[model samples]
Structure formats: structure tokens, C-alpha cells
Target chain A: MHKIMFVLLCLLSGCAAQHNNIKLANQLQQEPPEKILSILSEKEPDQSDFAQYYLNLGYLQLLSGEFELSIDSLLKAKNEMLSLQATSISENVAAGTVNETFRRYSGYPTDRVMVHNMLALSYLFNNGIDDARVEMLQADVEMKKLAQSDSLNGQLASTHLLSAIIYELLDERSNAFISYQLAEKILKERNISLPRGLKLGLLRMSDKMGNDTQYQYYSKQYPVLSKLKQVRQKKHQVFGLYFDGVVSNKVQQSLAVPSFNGKQIVRVSMPAYTSVQHRDQHNQINDNEQKINSEVVENVDKLVREDLDKEYPSILLLTTTRAIAKYQLVKEAQDKDPILGILANLATIFSEVADLRSWNMLPATIQFSYLETDADHIVVSTNHQGDSVVELAALKQHVILSTGLSDKVFHYEQ
Target chain B: MKIQSSFWLAIVASVILSACSTSVERLDAQQQIDLSGAWNDTDSQLVAREMIEDSLSRAWISKFVKSEGKDPAVIVGRVKNLSHEHINTNTFIANMERELINSGEVQFVASSANRQEIRDERADQDLNASEATRKEMGQEYGADFMMQGQINTIIDVDGSTQVRFYQVNLELISIKDNRKVWIGEKKIKKLVKNSKLRG
Candidate 1:
């Protein structure tokens, strides 16, 4: 008996397990798979076959092997079914069909137990097994709470199967197989055919303990499981994203990989990305600046600022070969910008200042990147090439790098 | 008396003619050259400035710095000339830097090229024995930022007019933070009339 269910002595008239079956079926416009799942699970069941919509939609994504997203949708349907399974109590109990709360949900729409089992199976078989088991654990925790109230619910084999897969992955083999055996027994007693690979594994374990008939039975079952596996392989399509050679290196940089030393190292400093920088940029103001309202600011100064040199955070270093330098200037020597003289003069002053300041912000501290084209890597124009037309179109390619750091120089990339 | 009068007038006319022509041209052995209009050096500067500023715009430096990030005080560093020609990208950067700074959105660190002038001024400020004693200025921090790069150019001529292209790139790095925070690029194109090629 499912513990969450109750026996109503008074039969509510016309409710006949058709609680929500009055609506017409309609399809939704294309949307993110997650949304479709939610609408299906939340709609009234008997009045409309909303559950079927979820089931069919989820099936398409699942069969396509978009496991994480597919499972998310399936779980929504599972949640709806579980909620519908809850019946109003009459302070009494019944057995057998009375505990079919899953079927008796809202409209008594369909055989929902099968749906739960299949979802559990799908979660286990598809990608990210651990994620699937996390949901199953939540179900178990909820089911346990219900049992104390009604005493009708018993251990569900589907939940155990999910648990077994998780435990096996976690290397708690003994517990995993114990759960697996319980599921096999419950399934067998229901006269369901045990898939052969699983049946064989269990039989082999039993046979090791001297169970002869069990060993022989599952050995025969192995061929069928093997065939099912082959069919599944043929039915499923596998797609992959391939990055070759230097291209892979570029991708790694954009993704921000940590260095071999297992330290966070970023070559190009995007200090603004840090929460501390955000606080500094948005919150802290110099005395010279005018004051603004406090509420207008986001609370970001809460964290302490750490030195970046010591931190060595992981970084994505983006590079490009297809780079062009173009400018627009109205030249006047008589009115030659006094600022130009000042700007040029900074170099000489800084070089001398570097000696006085012992390599402070003086000079030599400035870093630069080179624009490499087929022509040359020259930094300054001798004559008038910088204003050339058709610079960017002639670019070769771009290099996006995930790079490591060192005390001496920033590594090109790892 | 009539012959003497004609001689005086002729002398006056010669003086006026010499005075009018002399300021306009200077003798170089057998030939005289004109110094008015544009000098080769000024042309060098115009072409260089155009090239560098063009590089800056194409580099899209503003798009990076002004993009929802903290405005760093950029300091101008070395605009070295590695080419045979006298390359001056600083003048180009100065214009861009002013635009960046004056927007009231950005700040520029004191240039490295001016550090000693600052120092010598500070040094001149010190007390000395003589009434004519010069003061040495006190020291200041290295610029909180540095912006510097190079400019390269290509030129070709079709008769009197020439086509030229220039690229100038600048990088801004913070001193205290040691972060390369900004990059600016600009390129210049021009058609200049060549007096030497005239018919």
C-alpha cells in the first residue's frame, strides 16, 4: 500500500478518476525544452492529456540523448504525478487497487507507475547519472515522511534501482548490488522480463553463492539484453564537437583553464570582473567626486580585496591574428598639439624616472601586444602607412588563448 | 641735372626689386629654394599623425576602455622609431589621449617622457647657496598607466600625388596594478601633392 493514499468512505459522485479530462489538446509554439515540461505537468490531467504532451515531448529530447535537459522535463511530470497521487483521507485504509494513488491522480489519467519507472531507467541510462540519483534521493526523503503519516507506502523498487546505480558509481558495490537484487526480485515477481545483462550479472552473483537454477536462467537472458543494447546503439545518434591542434588551444583559453601548478593565472587582467573591482568602480568614490544615494549602489564592498600577483587566478587570454590599426587625425604643426609634445616627452622622462624610481610606474613597466600581418611588425610609422585603407580585411585569423602565468613572463598558452 | 635724376631713380628701383625678391628665396650655390608653405618635416608629422590616429581608431581602443569598466589613468610611454624614418606617434596619441581624458570619463598618468623634467623642476626647488640657485623638483610615482606603441607606413606615387598608409597602436598598462588594461589603434591614408613632379 502506498502510504500517501487514503480510503474515502464517501464516494464523491461523478469524480470517477476523471478529475481534469474536459479540455482539448493543443500544441505549444517551439520553446525551450524546460518550459514545455512545466506546462505539461501543471495542466489539469483528465480534461486534457497534458501529461501525454510532457511524456511525448520529453521522449523526443531523451531519445536524442540531451540527457540533462530531458531529465529536467521528465522530473516535472514526475512531480505532478506524485502530487496527484495524494488522496483526501477518510480515517480508514484499503489494500491492492486502493493504493494505486499514482493511477488515481487528478484524473486517474494513465498508468503513472510505469512512467516513474521509465524515468528512473532513463535517468540511469542517460548522461549524468549522479544528477539523476540526486532527484531520486529527494523522492525517497519525501516518501519516508509520508509513510509515518499513512503507513500505506512501502519501499519502491524503482527508487532502489536509482539508488543502486548511484551507489555502484560511488564504489559502494555491496550496497549497490543489494539494492539491485531487491529491484530484480520485485520486478520478477510482477512477471516483468528482466533485461538480460542485468539479469546475468545478478544470476552470476547468486550462482557464486551456489544458486544453480538462478545462474542458468539469467545466462539465457544475457543474449536478449545484449541484443537490446545493440538496438539501442543503432537507434541512438551520437554527435561530438572536435577542435584540432592550435584551434583547441585557442578554445582552451576562452574557457579559462588553470595552469599546471593548479593556480588561477590570467595574463590579461580584467580586474573589473572581480567583485572587489566592481565595488571599487561602483561604490567607493574619491572625495573630489560628488556624493550619490546609497540605495542606488549594489552592495559589493563586502569582500576584502586580495593582491592579484599573489592570487594568480586562472584567466582566458584572447588573441587574434586578424588585427588592424587605423586612425583619423587632422594634422597641425604650427598648432602642433602641445599635448603631442607632452605625450612624446613622457617616454624620455619615464626612462630616466625608471632609474630614479627603481622601476616603479616610471617606464619599462608598460606592456604591449604586436599586430602581426604579412607585411611587418613595426610599431611606429616612419612615413604614413598607419592610415592605409583595407587594413582589417587583410587580417589572417584570430587567436583566442587560455594562458598560464609565471614570475618572469606570461606564458603564451598551455 | 636730368642724367643725375635718371641714375637716382634707377638705383631706387633696383633696391626695391632686390628687397622684394630676397625674402622669398635663399641661394643654394646656383639655385634658390622656397621655404614657405610646407616643410618636409611638417609633412612627416602630418602623415605620421594621420597614420597613428587612424591606427588608434581601427584598434578600437575606446570600445574596450569605455566598455562598462573602470576608467584607468593611462600614461604615455615610449613611441620609439625603429624605422629609418623619423617616426613620431606621440603627437598622434596626444590627440587621442586628450579625447579620452576630457570626456570626463578617463584619466591619464603623467608621461614617462616628462619624468626628468618633473624631477629637474623638483630638484630646482631645493634650497641652494646662490641667489640664482635653481630648485630641483621632488620625485613622483611612475605613471599609474603607460600607453605606447609604434607606427609603420607605406607610400607610393602616381606622378605628383602620393598615397600613404599608416598604423599606430598604443597599450595602456597600470603601474600599481600591473594590468594591461587598454589598447588603442589607428591608421591614416593620404594623398599629397609633389611639387617636384610638376610639369
Candidate 2:
């Protein structure tokens, strides 16, 4: 009888499962950005949702061309993350009694990196290049923190590349070269192969700085670096678009753990985000025969998966312990009285909700493209669809056009 | 036992309520309080004091006083902010102007924008005010020297550590000979601790 009860209790406590946000994710996919923003903005900064709400609302605002509002929301999300500390007894109790989902929304590391990246993009779109540079610098700081503490191997290549582009815009070649080198090093460390555009940038910059040795080194390293064409004399520009697909949704997993007696079962639910296929479409523009292919520059999904993988062990242990304790308590109540046992069992069953919360709006992948164009008017397409024909009158001479879900262009000369 | 538990809950509620109540206390304005690690009034005042002291100690002021037999007519020029942070250079500029004017060692003239406003008022006086008090526009005192400056910053960050270095450079140029007479520079470095948690 005791063996049967133990089996029943173990079966009652389920393994961790994902909290499903497929409905919300579907809304994000189908609804217009403005509508989504309006709906999400209503619940922003709510105590229950806290960090994730701001994260989603801010990104939605970014997609809707409200750069300032997006920064505001992202900053709020950042503040929430900063205010959270190591788990306290209150949090532990809350996780046990209510659910882990009800616990404080201390954000994931990747979420923070994305916040800074989005803020930089916001500043860049609003013609605040200097502010954009600062935001990118802050992102680099955050990345370094994660790398040092979490033993993450790579840097945020996208943010660093953006910083390099900003430096290039300001005509600060040395800073740009250093940023590119950091991006290259981090990407290599993380086992991500160097993209042709980045290698081309490194090669051209070193050559211009008269670093013949460095230029020769990269040329030999990339071998294809020699074959890569450069349009140096005429002023040309490249547009980069980064698209992040829908991130994995969280789902609820119910496990039944056998109790101390044969007749009883304890059911537990935990939330998780399962990895899925990432569909990324790149955008590129061509002027004459010089067209730069769009590359998948950053994979945000992989970073998120790595974070989850690191935390899974601890999370599982915590869930299992909580389940066991609750099951034992119910068993003790049953030994006392039938009514008390029934009440305890009912309470556990009803409150066994999985913490199914995440920043559901995050894209799984980040894609980028480079175009060499001198035209004052250029039509760039992403996902084989032309979103907009960007006017370059404001960005003549040298231009850097960047886009995420929406597109932005910057044109400046020193 | 139930009554005792109720009493404890009531006490806890009151404590929480008291904690939530807002309270405000005023502090001295001159006190240096670094909150966001951004440029603050203390920085502005410190730069103003240092730059004024350095500028007055330079040979330009005494040389002008010796050569022309009067205090040099000085005017504030453009103070450009080339730093990554959005700093209002005017805050410190006004502070320095106050220090220079109070020193009484330099005859401070109106900057071009201020002069324009003065000219506009003088023009108004020409039409509306008494003839004896009507001020002439072109007869206004021309500055012998102009002070201009630029604010530049360099930031280095690693993990949770950030070091921000700021350099403010001011130059007093002779309008007649276009010779730079006094160059005053103030540098500030701050080691700021950043929150390692990102989101």
C-alpha cells in the first residue's frame, strides 16, 4: 500500500511544461501593430505581468513607428528587472502556493540585450545618432556582464555591428574597426561563421587605414575576401533589415505523481518555452551588379534556448521538491480527517497552474542585408514583399538603411 | 487564537501603509547628489569655478588691462556639446558668466544673441521712449575677446563597470588679432556602477 501511494504521488507531480501563449502570439501575427499596441498598452506595467508586458508592448510600439513610446516602455521593463534580487522566502512561498508564474518577472538575459538593441534602433530612427551610440554601448556593457557571469561564449554581434555602423557614420574609423573586431571575435567564439559583409567591412577598413598586414591577414583568412568587390570611389549605401520571427510559445505540462498510498495522485504543472523552426526572410537592394545578400546575422532563439538550458536543472529540482512537499502535506491531512484531506487535495489540484509567461512577441531569428546603392530612391524588399520604397533625399551621399519589422534609413557625411 | 492572528494582520497592514505614505524632505541646492550619474548642477558649478579661476589667472586679462588701460570687454560665444550625453552646456555657461561678471576683472559685453535682443529694445526705445534715453544700436560696446568651448566625452564600459571621461575645453580669442589668449580645460572622470541585470 505504501509503495502504491509513493508511485501515485510521484506521478501526481508533473515535469515542467510551457505556458501556451499561442492565442496572443497569433494575435501578434495577424493584428496590425497599432491595434496590438493599443491592447497590450492597456496592461503594461501591471503588477502581475510586469516585465514581460513592457517588453512586448515596447516592441509592438517599435513596429508601429512610435520610437519614443517604445523607449519609455523598454526603460520601464529594464527598471523592473533591475529591482528584482535573489529569491526571498516570500517569493518561494508565492511560487509554492500560487504558482511560479505569479512570482516576480525577473527577465531573461536575452530580453535585456534586446531592450538595449531596440533602444539603439529607436534613437537611430529618430535621428539621435549620438544617443544611439550610447544605447549600443550600454548593450555592450550588458552583453559583457552576461558573458562573464553566465559563461556565455559570444557577444551580441548585432548590437556590436550596429555600433560599428554608427562609428562609421560619424567617420570614426578606428572605433568602427575596433567594434568590428569585437563582433568578429565574439561571433567566432560562439562558433558562428563570419558573414561576407562583415569580412568585407573589415578588409576595406584595414586597407584604407594602410594596415597592409591586417588587410593581407583577413584576405588570406576569408580567401573569398579577395574576390569580394568594393565600390570605393562613388558614394554608395547599404540597407540592412533584421527580422525576428515569432519566438517559441510556453505550454503547460501536467505530471501526476503517486502519493504515499495507492489511491492518491498529485498533479503538478510547470511552464516552459520549447524551441521551434525559425523562418527568417532577408531583404536586399541591388544597384547595377553590386548586390549584397542578406544574411542571418543573429539568432535570438538560440540564445534564449541556451538560457533555458542552463536554468532547466534548477527549475526542475525546485518544481519537484514543491510537488513532493505538497503531496506529503495532503497525505498527512488525510490521516487526520477525510474532510481535511479532500480540501487539501482540491486546493492543490486547482492551484497547480503552470507559470506560462514569456515575452511572446520576441522574434526567433535576426536577419540582416547589405546593399550598395547610390540611387536617391531605392526599393528594398523583405520576405519577397516590398514593404516600402524608401526615399533617400534625406540620406544622400552615404546612407545606412536599417529595418526590423519596419524600416528606417540614415544618411550623413562628414 | 483567531483574534490574536487578526490583531497581528492589522498591525502588519498599518506598517505597510505607513511605509507606502509619501514624504518629502528638502535638501540644500548646493549639495552634490549623484543620482543617474549624468551631468548635474555640481558638475556645472565645479566646471564654472575652475574655468573662471584658470581664465582669470591667465596673462590675457592683465595684458589687456595694461595695454588698453581698462578691463577687457569679453562676450560669451557658442559652447558646443559634442559628447554622447545630451548636456545643456548653457547651464555651466551661465554659471561662468556669473563668476566672470562678479569678479569685476573683465568687462562682460552682451553675446551676439543678447546683443540682438538689446538692439531690438533700443530700436523700440527709438520710437517710443524719451529722446534723451533712446539707446543707439551700432554704438554698443564691441567685445575685445570671445570665449567659446566644446564638451567631449569618452566612455569605457565592461560588465557592471563604466568609466566616463569628460573634457570641457574653453578658449578666449582676441577678436582683433584672432590670437587665442587663454585656454582653460576642465576634465571629469566618473566610475559608475551599472546594474548587471539586463532586460
Candidate 3:
């Protein structure tokens, strides 16, 4: 009986491994990105959690300006996510018997699409335009697949806008127009107001593609399309992307119910998000005469919350069943011996933890702004950092990516 | 009780040791081995071989040879990879070059990078080497046609099953007239099913 209790305790201890992940999430907010990256890089790959590991590592590497390494890590994460799409019987059994964390961290729907988005950015930063185009097409395929499964879960406006930008850069005006249209449709479906940059892109692509009716509709509605058209031939264009603060970390919520005539305690644990306060901050880009503030394109916090909400019912059912099963085991042990019952109850209490694992290193919101200028460079500044100059040189198009966590700015030109 | 403990301990030890061990095997390179079902060497080689074969048999090569009174010089240009995978287009281009050169029907010139290196070597010889052995710069043959292409793929995934369709398109364009003299296309489709259980 004692041996059985010891084995159960050991298994429950294994379920508590996510405490380290929670600690790491806390560390991400305090430590420098390079230090955190070094720590994550030193970790050996956990086969079951490999996707989550690489996902976090890749994002940090991207923030640290390691474009090539980030691309490699993100690709590995993508491949692992693909392979893990198949249901694992053993992992399912572990999930049912132990805790939800025992199951592999096969990415959520948002993660699947974001993986391709990040890969596209990584390729663009590395000056691999053709590879970036491939990632955008893959993102489109991923979004379509996600739409087939769940109508509203995987549609990301940032991905579509980025795809449109890449297509326009490649001189594929027709594809660029389609992508811009898709981005607009997604924003409309989600009830998110279209940003000026996206609106301008639609207007420009529509006018270029000879869609007079749609162009006229937007021009009438926005009234700024005329001004945008006037500056269309500005010799150089700059697009600014700002990744906001880290996304919220998931915390465990436990509910205990007395059962078996108030003798046995049944505990149900589920993952939940705590409200974050700094959700509205954004970065600003400035030239000598004008200042452009990035508009929120994707609120990653809301996407994560929506993803969790969609799966809440199933999670509740499974967690309730597991809790009841665990309570019954404790009751049986008590009927046999009081000592065994006490030990089993202790194990249950320790092991009944929610799966708090997530790709927590992602930004809370992704913002975008566009500027068409004939100038050589522009100044970008955030609340936490001073102004930084981004040189455009003679490039016809340029992209600037910055994150709130660091002052480092990554740029690419074409 | 002791026997049971020993037996369990042996089982755990064996499992750990087995997992820690690594194994290696060698086989013929030409043998087709599909793992993860993404694009591989076999697909690259087969596509290059068949596409080049089709391009060489077309009327463009015979017409060029008859009109020019010699085998037309060819240069391999950029073969863009626009697929989901990071395919090494260089290997595919090299395979096509090998096939074209081995056919004994066309002349193959060095690519841009290789030509630059060769030009540098000739310039070095002009300054440092004896004049009797120096190679002239302007005597090099200009390519009559350039081979350029792109690889594209469409993947459809359902549950544990995925169907990958790859389309490779190659075109030979006349350098002087900018006319596409020949176009060759090869398509490959694969159906992959992944197992749902792990040991």
C-alpha cells in the first residue's frame, strides 16, 4: 500500500513540471532577452514539449536580432507542430490519468498560423524574399485549414496584411490586391476597425488593379485616399511593425468540492488568464514633419483568450471526470486502509494542477504603420526607449521591426 | 518481493540503455526513401532528369543547332524555390546541367559566380603567368539561351493525412530575342499518412 502511494506521488510530481515554465515566464519580463535566450538555448529538447520550446526560443531569437537562428528554430517548431497533429494514444491516456500537461503541447490554432507569420518575418529580415513568399502562401493554407475546422478562430489580419505587403514588394499586384481584400474581410468579420495603413494598401492596390467600383467606394468612405494617391510615387516607402509587451501567462484556477458524504475532496483544476494592464500602449514613428502611430492589428491576448474559451467546455468535462476518478481512487483506498487513504489524498492534492503551458513569449499586440517618403530615413521611438534612426538608403521599400522589450530595431530593404 | 523489484529494475535499465544507444545504416544513394514526405533528393533528381530530357527533345534544340551551325551554348540561371520547403535549387540546377552536358547535344557555360571566378583566374594569368599559356578574355562563348525556372507546391492536409503536389517549371529563353524557345513542366504528387500512436 505504501509503495502504491509512493508511485502515485512520483507521477503527480511529474505533473508539477510546469511550475518551471511559469517561473520562466516571470523571468522573461525581468531579464534581458539575450540572457533568457542563452538559458533557453542551453535546455535539451523535450520531445513532448519540443514545439513549445522552439516556439519560445524562436521568438526570443527574433527579438535578439538572430534572424537565421530564429528561422531555423521556428521551422523546427512548425515541423514538430505538423507531426504532432496526429493524435497520440499514449499522451491522451496520460492526460486522462494524470493531468492535461501530460499531453504534448501541439500548438493551438493561433500558434499554427503565427508560426508561418513569424517564419515569413524571419525570412524577410534575412533578405530571402522568395522564401518569405513561400511562408506567406503556407500561412494562407494554414488559415484556410483553420477556417475549415473553426470558422472564426484562425483568421489573423496581420498575416494577410503582411502577405499583401510581400506580394506588392514582389511586383505581384493582382495577388497583393487579393491579400489586401482578405485582410479587410478578416478585420470586418472580427469587428476591428481597419487601420489607416491597411486602408491605404487596399485603396492603392484596388486603384492599381483597375477595381474602380471598390476603389470609389473606399475613397468615398475614407476621404483620405486622394491624399494617399498624391504621395504614391514618393521614391521610398517605410513600414513599421511594433511587437508590444509579453502576452499574459496562464494561471491555474482550482475548485474543490466535498463529495462521498463530505468525506472525500474532489478538486478540479483549469487554466485561466489574469487581466493585464498595459494593453493599450503602442510605438510611434516620426519624420521631420509628420508622426505616425502604429495601430493595433492583432491583439494576441484576445486571440489566446478566444482560443481558450472555445476549448473551455471540453476541458471542463475532462477535468471533472478526472477529478471524480481521482476522488473515487482515494475513497477506495480509505475503505481499505486509513493510512493509504491519507497518502493517496495528499498525492491527488499535489497533482491536481492545471496545464499552464503556452507560447507565452509572444507579444500582447502586434501593431503596424506605413509611411511613404522621399527622405533617406525616419525616426522611431517608444515610451521606454529613445528615438532610433532607420536608414532607407536607395531602397524602394523598407521594413522596420521593433519590440517593446528591447531597443533593438531590425530592418530589411528591397 | 525482491524478485519483483529486481525484474522491474532490469526493465527500466534496459529501456534507458536502449533509448541512449544510436544506430547507423548505409545504403545505395539512388534508393528512394521517403521520410516525412517533404521534397527530397529523389524528387529533385527525377524532376531534373525528366524535365531536361523533355526540353532537349523539343524542336528548339534542333532548330538552334541547324540555324547556328553549331551546338548552342547554354547557361543555367536562377531557379527560384517558391515551395514551402527550403529546397536547394542549386542541386536541381546541377542535375539538369549534368543531363544537358552528358547528352552531347549542347554546350554548357559556367554560371555567373563560376564565370566570375574563372575570369579572375584568367586575369591573374594575364599578369603573372607566361604569355604563351595565358587564355584570352574575349574568346569565351556567350550563352545562346538561359535556363530559368521556379518550383511551386500545393499541400492539402486532413487529420493525419497530407497530399503534397509539387510542380516544377523550366523554360529556355533565347538571350538575344528574349523569346521562350522551350518550356518543360514536371509534377509530382505524394500521399502521406502518419501513425497516431507513439511507443
Best by lDDT: 3
DockQ winner: 3
After superposing candidate 1 on the true structure, give the runs of residues whose Cα lies further than 4 Å from its correct spot: A1-52, A85-126, A138-163, A192-196, A203-414, B1-199
lDDT of 3 by residue, A1-414 (tens): 567667666555545446665677678777767888998788775566789989999999988989899999999999888878777888776677667877878888889999988988988999988888888988888887678533679889889989998999988888898998898888888888888888888888888888899888888878866576756488877888999887888988998877758777777889998876765678888878778999988888889888888879988887877887788889999999988887778777766778777888888899999888877878999887678998889879988998878889999898
Task: Rank by DockQ, highest first.
Answer: 3, 2, 1
In candidate 3, which residue pairs get closer than 3 Å at backbone N, Cα or C atoms, i.e. clash?
none
Estimate TM-scores for all models: 0.23, 0.81, 0.94
DockQ, computed on Cα atoms, for candidate 3: 0.59
- Give the Cα lDDT of each candidate: 0.36, 0.71, 0.85
Ranking by lDDT: 3, 2, 1
* Candidate 2 Cα misplacement greater than 4 A, ranges: A1-22, A85-89, A96-98, A221-232, A260-264, A384-387, A394-414, B1-14, B35-39, B67-94, B107-199
- lDDT per residue as tens, model 1, A1-414: 121112221122112322221111111112332343344446544412334444544543443345555566566655554444434342112111121121222211111332443354456555434444444444444434333332223334444554554554444556556666866765565344543324433543444455666556655667554343333222111110011110000001122333344322212112221221221111111112222111111010110111121112321111111000000111121136645433322221211100000000000001111122333111121121121111223323211111011011101110
- Give the per-residue lDDT digits (tens) of candidate 3, residues B1-199: 9999999999999999999999889989899999989899999889988998898889998888788899999999999887877788989999999999998889999999998999999999989989889898888889999999999898997766779999999999999999999988899999988897654
Residue B116 in candidate 1 has what lDDT? 60
